[model samples]
Target chain A: MKTDMSIRMRTMLYGLMCVLLIPFVFPTWWMVTSSVKPISDIFAFPPDLLPRTYDWSTYQRVFELQPFAQQYWNSGYIALLVTAGTMIVSSLAGYAFARIRFPGADAIFMVVLLGLLIPAEVTIVPLFQMFNQWGMINTHWPLILVPVFGAPSVFSTFIMRQFFIALPIELEEAARVDGLGRFTIFRKIALPLAKPALSAVAIFTFLHSWNLFLEPIVFISTPQMFTLPQALTQFTDAYGGAMWNIQLAAATLTALPVLIVFIVAQKQFVEGLAHTGLKG
Target chain B: MANVTLSQIKKQYGNTPVIHGVDIEAADGEFVVLVGPSGCGKSTLLRMIAGLETISSGTLKIGDRIVNDLDPKDRDIAMVFQNYALYPHMTVETNMGFSLEHRGGTKTEIAERVKWAAEILDLSNLLKRYPRQLSGGQRQRVAMGRAIVRDPQVFLFDEPLSNLDAKLRVAMRAEIKNLHRKLKTTTIYVTHDQVEAMTMADKIVVMNAGEVSQVGAPLDLYDRPANRFVAGFIGSPSMNFIDGVVENGRFTAPGIDLETPSFTAGETSRQLICGIRPEHLVIGGEGISAEVSLVEPMGSETQVTFSLPEGTIVGVFRDRIAAKPGDILTLGVQTDGCHFFDPLTDLRVE
Candidate 1:
């Protein structure tokens, strides 16, 4: 009776899952198919599963319309910097909060977590003014610095704190006995054990900087300085008309690298996480 | 090997005093075991000695130096934690050699020391395996091996065998004893198991409620505990207590009477508690009559639970119990080995 019930439940779950998958899968499918289709045939009824005809020159138009390669580099390097910076900052703060015993440590950690409650959109006006005052406006500095040290990093810090709090404290004790000072133990012992949590933080921080459309549009005015997300919207003809083929072509390029990175590194870090649940 | 002295050591966590001021002296090359119930502050005192905990109000000296503020590594002690605390990422050889590397040992020196420890622990063949690849007993040996590679001035073990199966615990107990004999290190081990303490300790410190109850050799504590708590805690089946009053050269309770020695003669303290061990009671003898409540038989001996007029207590008889439950067995208590405590103070009386 239990097996019968589970079988029916599983079939129903799969049916619901397939139904839920269409909205997520179809848009990417449409975007890729429509990027190659002639702009006239894009909205053809009973949407094409495969492109009916390929106008391969649309890809060339993506680079011709804007410095697409430059924008791609801007997003890539900024995301990489943010990921690396957040990993270092958050892990150190998280380890100290979780393991160290100092005066008012808990109170200080609570104050840091308050950053997570505020979003970047709410503080953009002041941030823009500060960056403008420093002559960092229209540069990638605001994009790189804000997310690494600001509210987004707080979420990463919280993830790292939760992971470190569950970590076997005895390992640190053993390291201390093994002649390691605090920083050495953090680097050699705590950091290696924290690969899974750090990977998750990396994925979040990278994507945050990669898909930062509002910040780019607000801070950067020149097409040369625009990130990929902002530059995708720049493929417009005169009289404010949208260039559909070139825009889709640019958008696809922006999304594919992130998708491929997730596919490759996810297996490594996911399995590493399974090994951290040991009681010791 | 060096002596470790903890003088009036105290521990408090934000005004909550967990370990009250206590003093213990472990002579050089002595194996000291701190045995107590859980939460009795045995482990706390060991951590203080290891420099892992702050000595709130005392001087802790190792050999010739006052190391109260020294770090664990600087104190030159190696500890085996209860869960082994092996670095999960490193191989067994690296885990054992990790300390030597940090202390600026050359690669060859570290490797040679690790190899020596591995050979001693029978882990020479498994040096390349990670902790996840080892079984519980093997991991325990690796933890010991890590401590051995350092060859520190002192060794500390915090209930390191509690995670193993019973048969393995017995075997490891012998191994640790043999290791202590060979190394002759000033060691402090903490456990709640009295049997482990009795078998392995050169000197035993029994603690209760953040205070030291007694300190003596293992056989000395078993033969003559200093208090009711010590008497009750040190024995295997635990010593049974009969509460009563002594008057006119005899101690008497409900259906209980025993001749008193003249040492407490005319003493004002009449209220008494008598203790006798399970193995001291002999069945089918002329003494207190008890109806057998249950009978548990081992091939070497039989354990019988019974009720006298006062209360229920357990007894182990070398001979087989002939009768079933509800059978009357007159049991004898070896009074020469019996103990008396003053009920008010719970301290043993002469």
Candidate 2:
């Protein structure tokens, strides 16, 4: 009798979990399935969950519509730059804020944390004007620089700070007694042990830069200069009607690589974030 | 080996003071232990010597050079920490050799030094294992190896064995004492355990409330503490202090009175505290009558708690005493071993 009840409970739990997972999993499924459907089949009364026929031309048309490959490259490289840059800048600044005892460190850290309070929308006008004055408006400068150095990366900095703070202080002290200076100790001891936090920050920063829409739309003008999000929106027709198939194809192209990478290395992805001292 | 001298050492966290002016001197190759209860600033003092803590105001000298502003690397000192502090990411060999690698030593030299230290620490087979993979005792050996491989001018230990279980702690304590005997580097060890200080140090400095109460050989501090704090702190179970009045070569408490050798010392009106170690009290004759409260028997000796007219007192006896609770008994104190201190200042009034 107990075994029967436990088996029933397990089945119910699996059923509930799949239901809970649908909200997050459904949109990606719809996007992929609709991307390959014929334009007529896309809006069929049944609303195809799986297309009977694939519109292969729609995939090629996504690239033909406004330098889509270049836009993909722009998003990929910008995210790479942002991830690398944020990892360096935020880790160094975070470690300093957490450990080093320079004069006015706490005061400076408070000012840095104040970046969290001001929304990017509040500073977007100034940032756009500043980038324009430097003739970097049409370039990928805003997309790369804003997330790496601005408020977006502050959360990354906060995460790194939390991890570094929990690092056993005596490890660094032992490094000191081993005759290491502050910088050497940080590089050799503290940073290596901080791999989990760094991986978590890297994933978060990359995704943030990858999905950026507002900053790219505001700063970029040339269609060739557009990032993936901006390029995905350019698939509208002259009548201002949505090009559903083409846009879905481009959105899949933009989101697939990261999704596939996450799937393959999901253990590292989940465990890295879990151990980033964000357990609470 | 080098001598370390701290003259007028003081530490302050912003406006709040932690360590008041302290003067300590560790001779070349001497094993000196700084012992005190927790929050007494002994670890802070050791850290200041290791150059991990900034000396708020004072001159710290290693050999003849003043090292007050020098970095820890420039000071050439090694320290073993309470938690061992092995680098979690590095293998035991890499952790031991990491400092030398940073100092621009050749890879071969670094490896050779690491190998040498590993052999000494019996960590040869475990050199490739990371800290997380090793047992606590293994990690502790790696921490010690990291310190010794540098062959620095001095070594600082901040209660390095305090985290271990009792059996492991005793084993490690003897190993450390043997290591010190072999190397003979000038070392400053800090621990709250007086037994560690007693068994390992050539000299012991007892601290209380951030100030040194006494500095002497371990037995000297045990047999003749300079102040009441040291007397109470140096022995296990602590020395018992009894409040009393001294008049005309006699000291009188509530229920106990005793005669002492005549001395024309301090003011007779001044109140004093008399102290006796538990071991000095004996059963029977030439003493006061007391009510037995409790008795605890060890393999070699029994400790009995008794209530005298003045207050409660404990006596340790090697002979088996046929006494139980609620029985009246006479207790004698070894007169020569008694200590008197000025109650107000807590300083010995010998």
Candidate 3:
């Protein structure tokens, strides 16, 4: 990258990259265009990259067919709660494991990391039975609690711990010598300096909970309690035939808010993750 | 300012003890340096005094208070780490006044103190800059400025200048010494460089393998080192040691023959270790003879390494000899600065 390449080689390299970008770019292109297409034209042999004819009625059916407004609120609030909850739990656990000299900390951290190896699908049955025993099956507790305290949070904790470890020990020691106690040091020094890591944790936790599909279908039986991903599948006709255009419309609505958020904060989201540079 | 005292201090991790029982009495407003090789427990001792590391045993007292159980904040000492642990998020003023904020100082008082410290450290122009924005020397001064604002009983510096370039290190070294003179606060510095210890310390403690090898004024240790290790460690280019034995009235080695240095408990016909400083060797004198192997001209002085029959010895002389690698020279120790030790024990004879 330091040296300038020849004109032919640079052209070939950019050509190769463009070819590799198609599969990732085409699906989103189709998803947006198909959402606006008429149902009959959705199955056209040469798919309309841009819809040949528009139908605003499919978007109207998206709200009428289900409690789409309520489902939107459900997914939004659950993702927010899960993001905030995961941030707290992960930062506390990660700072303790990385900075404190507690006995058997390494052993406890290893046990916690085992959660990463076990997929949530592997334990969903047991979790459903437990939630049912507590009469919480139709509630959002499983949706919120599972992602916040379950395997998804372990990755956040691992990332936070890695960030906190690279934090210079002298800063905390200087804080201590400056008359700050352990909790005060964590609050004023550690937390303020952990913005990049916490932001990264927030984005990942939000997207994970927002796109959560399996837990919602298993836990919630009511259409009103459906999350965005669960509600996206409910756009079907009377005989259970897929309403392809309406389904795509609901999917677009479900994915739009998060996409907008990503676009708005993409710089911080990517650079915060890329650097994680605790250059203390 | 307060005098710091450590009586038989020790530190251990599990069952492995890194600092054996040691005692140091740093006078009020005095600068004491703990200098040693790496892993010699000098930094551990400094941390123990700073209350960053707990003492596994023994007593430590600052002023009149027994402070072994106190936290670092309560110990009333300020430490400047080698890395200059300035808060990356805060400006220079905020970082320096952070301690005063915790100690219940008002906003005006904190600002005044920060301003005063910044002025003293010549950092007034840098009050708003973050740590990463400052150069290495400026950051180091800000670190010292942070310590200065506290105005604590004692100042602890853990190799504060090790990260600077050579020229900056010398400049900062003088600045630190000048700061200590102005403040007149008790200071405890830890470093591995002997020159820093030699030039700056009012009293220097030389440690090895978790034990205090020797402790005295710098020149006192230099003039009359307690053992072969102290003699070899205190000087640059180190001292030349010859393994030999003393028989009757004379001590003799392969190319060294001199009168045996006498001590209180003297024994004739015994194994001995003779230590001669590089600067103490006199050329063209009525003394022992050896062949020169190399002549290193160092501007004001020249270093000559002589190839003895059994070993080699190096000498730094102010008088430049017209000598090459194959030249012959007569070399003799000026017994006034000569050191003799017990070969078996590696302890000083006197």
Q: Rank the candidates by lDDT, best first.
A: 3, 1, 2
Q: How high is each candidate's interface RMSD, in Å?
A: 0.4, 1.2, 0.5
Q: Give me the candidate number with maximum DockQ.
A: 3
* lDDT for B269 (candidate 3): 72
lDDT of 2 at B89: 81
A71-167 per-residue lDDT for model 2 (tens digits): 8888899999999999999889889888987999888888888999998789999999899899998898889989989986888888888888889
DockQ for every prediction shown: 0.85, 0.73, 0.87
Model 2 stretches astray by more than 4 angstroms = A1-10, A264-280, B246-250, B259-270, B320-322
Tens digit of per-residue lDDT, candidate 1, span A1-44: 99999999999999999999999999998888788889888888
lDDT of each: 0.88, 0.87, 0.90
Q: What does candidate 2's lDDT look like per residue over B232-260, in tens digits?
A: 99987789899988877777787666666
lDDT tens string, model 1, B44-163? Answer: 899989888888898999999999989999999999999999999999999999999999999999999998888888999999999999999999999999998989999999999999
Q: Which consecutive 10 residues in model 1 chain A have the weakest lDDT in total?
A: A271-280
lDDT at residue B269 of model 2 (Cα atoms):
55
Question: In angstroms, how far off is B193's CA in candidate 1?
Answer: 0.2
Candidate 1 positional error at B74, Å:
0.9
TM-score of each: 0.96, 0.93, 0.95
lDDT of 3 by residue, A1-280 (tens): 4345677788899999999999988888788888889888888988877887888888899999998999999999999999999999999988998998898999999999999999888999999999999999999999999988988788888878888888999899999999999989999999889888888888889999999999999999999899999888887789989898899988888889889888887766775576455331
